[model samples]
Target: MTGKEEPKEVRKYLQQSHDRIFENNKKWAEEMQKKNPAFFKDLSAGQSPEYLWIGCSDSRIPAEAITGLDPGEMFIHRNIANLVCNVDLNVMAVVNYAVRHLKVKHIVVCGHYGCGGVKAAMTPKDMGLLNPWLRNIRDVYRLHQAELDKITDEAKKYDRLVELNVYEQCRNIIKTAAVQQCWAENEYPVVHGWVFGFADGLLKDLKFDHEGQLKEIQKIYDLTKDA
Candidate 1:
């Protein structure tokens, strides 16, 4: 051949990651099968997850792995800062399907302490299209600006914003039509707010729980007659 063979490192660089990823997948599936012969079979039949997890798109925090749950245990939807914007149809669809179809017993809005979205929202520097998405977090800060401004420590302020953002998004879920209908009919699908501490690799519930908070918000937001 006229062309010399490519260098080993160059060839490796040109190769796609499919080989390693598939190898890992094969190993993972085999391990699951070894653990339980019916694991994949049962998962393939259908997913009847009890929870719908609305979490940050950050790779470090996978909804199932961190929660000690199996693949079919939780329905998932992820976005920046785990937002539940009323304008976002993607999240609304997930919630509608989970509450109305899957009948998930819990809906979780999980944010992480070191969320890039939240940090970016707190800054004045514009992030182009991301500015619109991150503005949701900024609105949360505006709602609790007095409380947030008092926290002179920047780190503490960031953490507080993360928690507050979770609470607001969880509230958004509570305000959804599908969730209200499901709660009225099935009396299920409670909403929860939580934060993951990157340092500890633990989930800490923020206690902005739907059951208790619903009564207060019902006066304004509840659409179901009996609820």
Candidate 2:
């Protein structure tokens, strides 16, 4: 192969990853057997993850690793731009299960400042296959276009857009029928907006609380309302 040619060992790399995971799991099982046998056996039965994390599909930001949580701690749903759409069945199913069955107390929408997906959404170019996914981010821009357009600093504008996108996605999650139903019946679960900073590997909460700011949205599913 030429010096500039891309590596053609994608399958080999995948095999290597499988090997590593096997070794890791073996070591983990051995440690668990030695130290915490009962806990391991209980975990084997099933998972009871408490947090539902909706995050970008960036390789850098791993939900489990960032939070330093174990395997069955956080249920995750990842997309290109980390968008929460009402019509997305896959995400909806995860949310339904997490809230209804698992009873997850927190639903976190995590976005990163250096997100390629958000950057693509800010541009006018055709993203081809990613158009539909990024369209949601574009909508966030449209909703706050006046503010975004007035910001002369390009870097600052991009950062603000990323934060805004997270807040909007958090709002979108609360607007879901299942989440609203959860709110109607109980107050256990709460939606939160967070941003992961790639530079420092720190998570900053955007303070977008679904319960406090979006009470009017909950009225849509109020069962007590006269029909």
Candidate 3:
């Protein structure tokens, strides 16, 4: 087909998809209101979430659905491979806001097995814009190279990398000043690492030691001087 003709067809399909989303949203809103008359009112008033969820931006893994959380129950931040880096303004701002303002009691860094970002990072090639972002996962592999090298099965190796990525990201969050100061002052927002598996739809907690990891990280990245 000609370029103009193709765009017309694509636009029609996208319009249909967009309309379907709003239709479903309207129905969902009606359902919520029916369940609780004050649902929308309470939601509009404000959100004081108890948990901050950091997870991969995979469409298959809906953090709220997997964790059985309501909309206002968890503040969420998602990125490719679920990475947490000091240089990333977006995630950094999210962490700071959640810890400082929201006072979230728990912060979960969740990654999933069979993640496209992790798989792409594993492949040694130039992925253009993705190279820099995926490099974080490569760093995770490098950190656990000896342990990862022991696994002969490629699938197992990939799975291990995903879990390790979550763990490292949790450590990264711990290294943040907002988290450190908040923990020192309130002893909350404990960081947790979790991995979601496609098969059987279960989350595998890596049993992150919040206080222990905080102490380990504070040896270098301590910022709780006032607290």
Each model's Cα RMSD: 4.3, 2.9, 2.2
Candidate 3 backbone collisions, by pair:
none
TM per candidate comes to 0.91, 0.87, 0.94
TM-score of 2: 0.87
With candidate 2 superimposed using the best TM-score fit, by how many Å does residue 185's alpha carbon deviate from the native? 1.8
> Model 1, poorest ten-residue lDDT window?
1-10
**Model 1 / residue 180 / CA error / Å:** 1.2
Encode model 3's per-residue lDDT on 129-208: one tens digit a residue. 98889998899999999999999999999999999888899999999889888888888888999889899799988999
71 Cα displacement, candidate 2 (Å): 1.9
Tens digit of per-residue lDDT, candidate 2, span 2-33: 35534666656767888999999999889868
Q: Give the winner by TM-score: 1 or 3.
A: 3
Write down the TM-score for model 1. 0.91
Select the stronger candidate by lDDT from 1 and 3. 3
Off by over 4 Å in 1: 1-11, 14-16
Deviating ranges (above 4 Å) for candidate 3: 1-8
lDDT of each: 0.90, 0.86, 0.91
lDDT, model 1: 0.90
Tens digits of per-residue lDDT, candidate 1, 38-153, equal 99888889989999999999999988999999888999999988999998988889999999899999998999998999999999998999989999999999999999999999
TM-score of 3: 0.94
Best by lDDT: 3
